[model samples]
Target: GGKNLNDHALVEVLANEAKNGIEWLKTIDANLSQVGSFGGASVKRIHKPVNDEGKTVAVGSYLVPKLTKAAEDKGVQFVMETAATELVVTDGKVTGVKAGDTTYTGKAVILATGGFAANTEMVLKYKPSYEGFVCTNAPGMTGDGIVMATAIGADTVDMEQIQIHPTVSQETSALITEGLRGDGAILVNSEGKRFFDEVGTRDAVSAAEVAQPGGFAWLIVDNKMVEASSVIAGYIKQGLTVEGADVEALAAAMGVDGAALVETMDKWNACVEAGKDEEFGRTSFANKLDEGPYYAIKVAPGVHHTMGGLKINTNTEVLDASGNVIPGLYAAGEVTGGVHGANRLGGNAVADIIVFGRIAGQQAAAYAN
Candidate 1:
């Protein structure tokens, strides 16, 4: 993980054949249940990579809409109703789930609803240390899957491994896609020089940003990089930035010292030219910050993900307290732990969704037999 790795960086690392560690994972046999983006499910989005130059926009989301559609078309019968309220089990084998008023029976049930970061009450109950910042997942993510499975007797893991983004925009807590820095975007303080390289894995970048001077920073993007990359366009559409014609103007608008920003930019510009970031080692393969109409967006810490949840085996079966398999039970996506040993890399979550989602779906369907 080099410096400045943002959401896009992680995505590229995964989709790029040479970089993706799990290249063989793309060939695995599996199916999907629910494939739409968790929060915004209705929008018709197709998968097409858009890059302004070699730089791209922050188009990375946990769930890719096109794949989501493909998963649905493949074998996943998306039941986008109310959350599952109860797991009907008899003789220690799960039978079905209670969605709302009606009961839906299945030979096997795969609980892949996601984590409880959005549920503060659940967080306090299981993980108390995360007292600051808003949880990263969509508000609807309330541990429904984990809780339902637990009621049927299942254990969770790495409850403490919550993946906090550590830097969100000041206005909407807007998520500037991790992809931005993957192409060499830089994060500067109010003073403008560099704080982090803005290039490696998401977790690593987040940790560095938080440890900086004020635990506050600015995600600086130049007009060139913005046009070349989807990361900037996505953020702009999301309105993460208060743009400026120059560095000073941006600093003034954000209430940071203009001269300090200028000086920071000077130092950073030198590093960009030299192809080395002494402080953070952001790779020098792409464009440097030499473009005009620079933009700076304010950012601070915010919870982005929770890494702890129901424990399951490779078969995607949720187990009970005594390490006994809860037959007819399965889990995929974020609901299941272990795929992310102790910490999840920047882009692994996406792979987790499709890859494990398929596993859970197939096993659940088979178990249903």
Candidate 2:
């Protein structure tokens, strides 16, 4: 609604956590590489340093397994395939979790079960308007942590706020990645008009997209942007992209106005030439949309992130409904909310997970000791 930074303190925390995360990754010998950047906010991607047939290599491939082995070496036991159904609380303190008729007691408990974007019922319950909208979260992201924690009176905040990404595929709804726009792709509507700054924040860009003639937009890029970026390669390999010899052909293929597309490109180039985005005030003009063999992908606001869950304080301690810290209960990662406020900027999730997760682990360990 306004230009001021909404979650300024949280943003600072995330930024500092990013530095801590990089140091921790180095300590663990994580096979990380900077893949690309996104938004005028200039967030970068960190992924495994491998070319796995052009597919995105998730952290589970290397990072998670290593961490698991380390934890196992330290006598940490993992209960496989068990769903925690409730928190076992006694005398105002959380003792452990109840899973399918068995209660696993612990000195302290930490919930890292992620957000509820994949649960359609929860989506409908919180955001009824997105009943039929596509979600880009894992199938198991069903708000299990929120349910269990709240069962013990954990207070949840901003439970209704969800983030809609600007560039998810029309066919498979796979995320096209904000890194594409960060690397200099432009968003054009059905009228082939540049509706907003292509590199604007996620919420702003998504809001502009859903308000277009159709409830979607098209990300247009040149051969240079396509070749310089890895995200497009995956999309192209999956047959989710449309290509043309030029802007006219691209617009025709996308069913957009060809002349308008040309004019929009002209104006965008002029903005780049002027070293300023006069139209929408985007700060990053990394590349000019001036190369041909143009490419495009249809995109809409897909449900990507939830900004709400069990509320926690800066110590990563989960709080109760009465604003008191829940004794022996710690939460981190996507399971706890109030870090990103209304809209999470791109790439902040990784920092949030690493930083607060480390904090939560330390606090839990101290509590146990």
Candidate 3:
């Protein structure tokens, strides 16, 4: 059920740490709930968190506040509006970080700043082919941590392996979650024909969409799916969805061939009812998209994740060009590479950040003590 894309040792470390991470979340009062299968996962192993009202909240949104509150309660001072300009190295060991004119000295430093997907120039420097691609990253994901670490002789890995998510709304640059397709949404081209399996991996689906005539597609879902997923409901509230009362109406609204869409919807509902996708060889099935009042979101590929950053070991210790650990320097999340290898599967990024973020904290603390 697992893709052997990454180093076996790294994957094993992630697998082991993921368990501890989930347990740690529970200890910190994270509201984790049922496990769901995401794209590229054969089993339902991705742990999702729900709010107190039992509404599914995006993992990052749910965890960030909880972790922040927990850390703040423990007297962790959060330095806001300060960007790290450099990493201070004392005798080949990282000792602190410099922000503007201020140097915050410490025994150990953790570079938790995110990836460079939002940095157009940095992204183009690594992968020139991604030019003109809309990024789904926040503006702050400018790889400042990576620049600081590299300036201090730290090495990076997989810098060119940036990931583009398939379902991103160009209008808002908002990432339409993969859960929509997993919950029974279908992607159709301008011709209103299903071109590929909607549940395929991000890279595969993105490529398929790029191959289409307009390099984009429409994700169609019925009211049933909207009711079943709060994520989709939120998308609608964000004005990212184009709604219609029926299949023909939705296709018309999407500027696709209405008759072709009707036929495609008929075939899709049949496949859902029969528990088989004969055309695309899709095995995963959810509720049929036959309910009235369908919604269509115009989506295309957008730069989502940079699968590379500062090279780090299993202990989250950042390494140098000679493959030696930079003592007292640690990194995690999208700032570190080798965890996801080339293509990161959905749900793994969350696991990566939580698992390795905890490890980096512990290792840095240990080094400091």
Candidate 4:
């Protein structure tokens, strides 16, 4: 729903900024993913010079493997299932988190528990119209960090600016990663017409796709698109996709008109030849749906992740509104604000967690000493 007309332009600027002089990152972290630029919520924006399909390669080759390895090599002493009851602040400096009767004493406790999108009551209290909206996040995210942070003074930004992914399975409402459509999936309505441009940001593309004739649109792809050879196929193997034999059969099952699908495909094939999308203005498409028994899967919007939280300095230190750094306190990951600004790109969240997690850990641990 949020459109950035300058998204592609910004990406180019950031890319140029990197290619020329990027030593700041090298000084901070060596094992970081070598991104040419940042701030694309989807690959289509980042690789504007390439087709939507190539972005999947960018993620699979560059982002995922690097982040996964970095996280494994630098594993935090994670204490899972432990509730952070309250921030133990003494004389206005956060020292630790108190959970149940036990105390987690540290120089700082990074409250990266994520947002309250999972909590219906909290959503209603803060963002009312978004209530009853089902959340796919862990059900335990009941504004605990927000509440706890508020009790001790923490500022949040863009609380109302929550972005929803469009391609959600209507029944289960699981978030279909935007990467699938990035790798050449078309969205079909009940009429079976290709409805939206699949090359936009995840949230915007999802909204456009599902807003067609169907209350739910099936994300259609070919066997070759999500086959074992496809980078997105790995996710399908991980139980993320629903496939069909052909487009007509897919339409029949999803209550889409088969004839409309044939017509839609004809026009789309024409556009694919022209090398430009007429309706959606997508010049960056990777593959055609020419090879398949086509596929269509259900989709809807579910809360992917929150983009707002405690304010932090560039060094990952939590700071108050008055530009005063909170002593004995640090933050990282999704809890730390301002890296991605209003919205975050797909792989960047993982990047933020890893890069800032190290800063928070080292700083917090050192401060503890």
Lowest summed lDDT window (length 10), candidate 4: 42-51
As for lDDT, the candidate ahead, 2 or 3, is 3
lDDT of each: 0.64, 0.79, 0.87, 0.60
Candidate 4, residues 310-338, lDDT tens digits: the string is 77765566666676777877776655445
> TM-scores, in order shown?
0.79, 0.87, 0.96, 0.77
Positional deviation of residue 312's Cα in model 4 after best superposition, in angstroms: 1.5
Cα deviation at 1, candidate 2, in Å, is: 10
Q: Comparing 1 and 3 by TM-score, which wins?
A: 3
Query: Could you tell me how far off, in angstroms, the CA of residue 243 lies in candidate 1 after the best superposition?
Result: 1.8
Per TM-score, what order, best first?
3, 2, 1, 4
Candidate structures ordered by lDDT, highest first: 3, 2, 1, 4
Candidate number that wins on TM-score, 2 or 3: 3
Measured with C-alpha atoms, the lDDT of residue 91 in candidate 3 is: 92
TM match of model 2 to true structure? 0.87
- By lDDT, the best candidate is 3
Instruction: List model 2 lDDT by residue over 284-353, tens digit each.
Output: 6667888888888899988998888888887789988898999999988788778877778676677788
Candidate number of the best TM-score: 3
- The C-alpha stretches of model 3 lying farther than 4 A from their native spots are 1-5
Please give, for residues 18-81, the per-residue lDDT of candidate 3 as tens digits: 8888888998899567677667766667788765556556887888889999999999999899
